[model samples]
Target: MEHREPGYVADKAQLLKRLRRAEGQVRGLQRMVEDDVYCIDVLTQVSAATKALETVALQLLDDHLAHCVAEASAEGGPVAEEKLREASAAIARLVRS
Candidate 1:
């Protein structure tokens, strides 16, 4: 198989930034728990962190659909089928999460 740059390569820096922010949010959540912060406040932070990660996931999915899937689809063979299946599985996982 040919190795290609990932769909997210173009936005790698931005993606990393978002991931770091999410990481910080998680750390904050840990601090909140350790400090015995209010339950609702902790929950709110959890929601924010979840949303941040979701946004990143959605962007990644969009990029994969636009680049990897599109390229594979144009080839129209087993690779295309595999990409589609992989994408479907990813979407299902995201939805379940």
Candidate 2:
């Protein structure tokens, strides 16, 4: 199969920015643990980091549905079925997380 640009290509920069911020949050979390910061404070930061990642995930999922899945569906064949299944699995994983 030919390689295609990801559905998130247009928003790649924004995605990277969010990911970097999340990375920082994680690093901060590590520092907090090492410094013996209050437990509640660490948990709050953890929630924030999780929320940031969830936002990124939702954006990517929307892009996939709008671009990859939509394009495959238009073609209407095994590719479309595969995309649909892949998307469903992704959604399930996100929900479980």
Candidate 3:
């Protein structure tokens, strides 16, 4: 990977916070399942966790495209092209998911 200035440094803390919340949600879902909570309720928690994960993944993808790709392009050469390719592949995976 090309070394460049951070794109989403400012949002790092917030991202961590969101991840922690997702972790808690996962734990909550586990507890709900263990407690034999209603089936719909457990499914609801699963949906929430999935959505939260998707949200975070989107944010990271956006940052990678905007900051990392931009920086790599500015630097120019094979490295930038590689980064672009990697980002494209990642996006494809995300879309499939």
lDDT of candidates 1 onward, in order: 0.97, 0.98, 0.89
lDDT (10s digit) by residue, model 3, range 1-97:
6355666776798788889999999999999999999999999999999999998888888888888888889989998899899899999999998
Look at candidate 3 and tell me the lDDT of residue 9. 77
- lDDT, candidate 2, 1-97, per-residue tens: 5789999999999999999999999999999999999999999999999999999999999999999999999999999999999999999999999
Model 2: lDDT to the true structure: 0.98
**lDDT of model 3 at position 71:** 82
- For candidate 1, the TM-score is 0.98
By summed lDDT, the worst window of 10 consecutive residues in model 1 runs over: 1-10
Candidate 3 local Cα displacement, residue 57, angstroms: 0.7
Ranking by lDDT: 2, 1, 3
Best by TM-score: 2
RMSD of each: 0.6, 0.5, 1.6
Candidate 2 local Cα displacement, residue 38, angstroms: 0.7
Off by over 4 Å in 3: 1-6
Better of 1 and 2 by TM-score: 2
> For residues 1-97, what per-residue lDDT tens digits would candidate 1 score against the true structure?
6999999898889999999999999999999999999999999999999999999999999999999999999999999999999999999999999
* Each candidate's clash count: 0, 0, 0
